[model samples]
Target: MLLPIFHFSAAAIDAYVFWYDQNYVDLPFKNPMVKELPLKSRCMFLTIWCLILQIAYHTVAFLNDVFGTNAASPKKKPTIRLIKDVLFSVAFPIAMYVSGAFWGIYAVDKDLIFPEHIAKLYPVWVNHVLHTTVAIFMFIELLTTNRNYPSRKVGLSVMSVFIGAYISWYLTVYFKTGTWAYPLFDELNWPLRIMFLLFSYLLVIAIYIFAEKLNYVTGSSKVEKNLSGKHKKR
Candidate 1:
């Protein structure tokens, strides 16, 4: 019951926010993170990608709970399960990384990621919506759903590739467009930029490993209580 409600709300909220984002238009703020420099240019941020994944994950979870529930399990449609797992794998860690990195940098230097003038272009709460709530929903899914986390080697490899791809993309965009995708890059010299990208890679990889173990211990077992009322693991 709660799971269904949560999923519905999450999906609806993400969809609404995503739609609003697509529709809103703004002047170029010179801050790459700000939406609507050209308007559609905001799509390039990794944060946007994570938001898209969150929307997909929650929509599927909502459908699974509403139509695929059974006495044995509340939500376990096989196809939906596979998608849910795959999205969760990429989405959760990426969400954590984006939220963590954004706030972490915002704390240290607002100009580095989100400049002061960027605040005027968008509402404060919108910042929370983009950077905070998505991760919160992913964390809830972790607690509420039964999941099969990929083995560490596979998980780490996949995340490494995912992180590598983004690094390549931002670098490519910078070289091609003469623009840095995020403001952090503008502050760094080449050596520091290299270190920053390396740190980003390690951070996402660590997030994947930690989340897998956390899920195994507290979230992914497939057992329930018996007639004696003792909980057991399967």
Candidate 2:
């Protein structure tokens, strides 16, 4: 139900953007991060990427949980945990963008107002930042605290990865399509771009700190007891 809605919205927006670009003026694909691809091709690629991300996330999570084959495993070596952590962290944000959840609202709006240039691009950017920050924070929490729920962490980690990749994709589009998604970032000034990146990094760091504090407060009661028990046994 939700998926169909997202699909319809994306198609409609893409069609509108195509019309606007051809008739209205020579708008770059940067604002909404839309390309000049045919609707069919865009949808096809979206579907393919969605399936790929879904499969990859689930496969890694299942392996980690059932076989202790990845980061979730208590007995696994640090190297395996590190590799899986990096992979899982990167997959999340990208999947979210491809799933259409990241830009669904903006895609449906199509008013060409508020966000100014590329209406859809605003939501995509916000979604990417929010989801990426949250996911990375959660992943760091899992690594530092060694929580038990691999499923939850995996879900978050995959979202983070997807978001990071989507941001990179948008940067590429900004260069190639010359359609600045955000007017603030569209200036093409190196200083502004660097500032934006720095801001994003700081936001992610703040989120990580909050997550760690929350983990300490919540997990301390349970994990501490368990650790104390093991120490006593020895």
Candidate 3:
């Protein structure tokens, strides 16, 4: 299970690197290690990030259950409390789906829009299905947990960070190699590219907000928060 997952993730990382090298307009870092690491180790790194998030989520919840206090409270177990602090106070918003959806859409469209040269190695439907499935699960979990709540500020901040990082990284590539990712963005006139970026960001934000609202209406908010506390703490 781990090996196949690792392989798939490695393939995904390779695809991203290929796209970045080909389409990135600016190259940020000249360090060979930085360029090579993502190509060779991004899969393992991302997988580790995911596993850490999962573990932290479960650990915090467990601690909360045992202590009968919110992890946010300073009086709780310091280690568990710190993890909860980071998970809820930092990573949650960052990991939220609002901005991620834009990349998800782009990943799908890159294949369809430029079928002639791109060869569409990965199936678009698979990307959509997998993303949607994981998103739904995350939503369900959030809704079921009592502490979960939608914050526009948090969502917006996350979106901003994602876009800023993506642009900055690509800009570095562009400067170094004069390339951009996803030719659709480069092929478009500047005006169209800007419009697309804005539209995708707005659409993703709206979708995420709507999902949060749905969770609220369905009374998943409390459940999700509670579960988060229970499952996320160690």
Candidate 4:
């Protein structure tokens, strides 16, 4: 319960900061991306929402354990566990990896990735707080807490939907505004854009496989149990 509250607060704070800091321009009504920045700008917001969902289920399960009540249903536990795994293993990694790449590019040549004006709004620490700290915090959680991952098929399917949906959303934003949401999309030609998207998805899939191996090698099998009614807490 307490941990969930902390995650919720942190995510909410980041959202607030982005909006408040980017308030210089009065966005046009036509561009939905500018109007709904948090929803369309980055996949980080989506991952944070996933984290909130994961924590909500975890809170319920924890309460049930403490109260000795079967409040957290068996069916719901599996679904939530699967979502948690997909978001942490797939979504979080994608956001971290993509952000790191662009942040590096921006460091080399700021104009190539982030425009001078936009770059000024986000200080170095702010960038780290938004992009870097999220993965670090979740990774620490994964290492300390027991987590049961869904099967590879389910994990891949879920992550596919997530990445596909974001692509569609960006396409919609482009159609509406006649511009791309992120600078990287603007910088790349159509062929390069398609290749980048494909590469990103493939990278996420590879990371998913790596996470499975890491979980096994770290003996999470002994610490975390599947949601099929066999769960142990250390």
Best by TM-score: 1
lDDT score, candidate 2, position 77: 51
Give candidate 4 regions above 4 Å deviation: 1-83, 220-234
Best by lDDT, which number?
1
| Runs with alpha carbons beyond 4 Å of true place in candidate 2 | 1-58, 69-73, 77-83, 87-169, 183-190, 209-217, 220-234
List, residue by residue over 1-234, the lDDT tens digit for candidate 1: 566788889888877777777677353645454333333776567887788778888888777666553122334346766666666788899999999999998889888888766666666666788899988888867765676655667767767777778778778667757788777888789999999888888888788878877877763333222221443332
Q: In candidate 4, what are the lDDT values of residues 1-234, reduced to their tens digit?
A: 433454455556555545554564333335554566553344333333444334443444343334432222243454445445445555445555555656676678777665767566666765565556655655544543345566778877877887787678767767765766566677789999999878877877777777667765675433333322354332
Question: TM-score for model 3?
Answer: 0.49
Per-residue lDDT for 127 in model 1? 75
Poorly placed runs, candidate 3 (over 4 Å): 1-132, 221-234
Ranking by TM-score: 1, 4, 3, 2
Each prediction's TM-score against the native?
A: 0.83, 0.39, 0.49, 0.66
List the candidate 1 regions with Cα displacement exceeding 4 Å.
27-39, 67-77, 219-234
RMSD of 2: 11.6
Name the TM-score of candidate 4: 0.66
Q: lDDT tens digits, residues 32-133, model 2? A: 435553432232132234444434443444344344332223554544344444544444333333333334534655332125554343355333433233
lDDT string, candidate 3, 133-176, tens digits? 33443444454433443266865675466556555665465555
Better of 3 and 4 by TM-score: 4
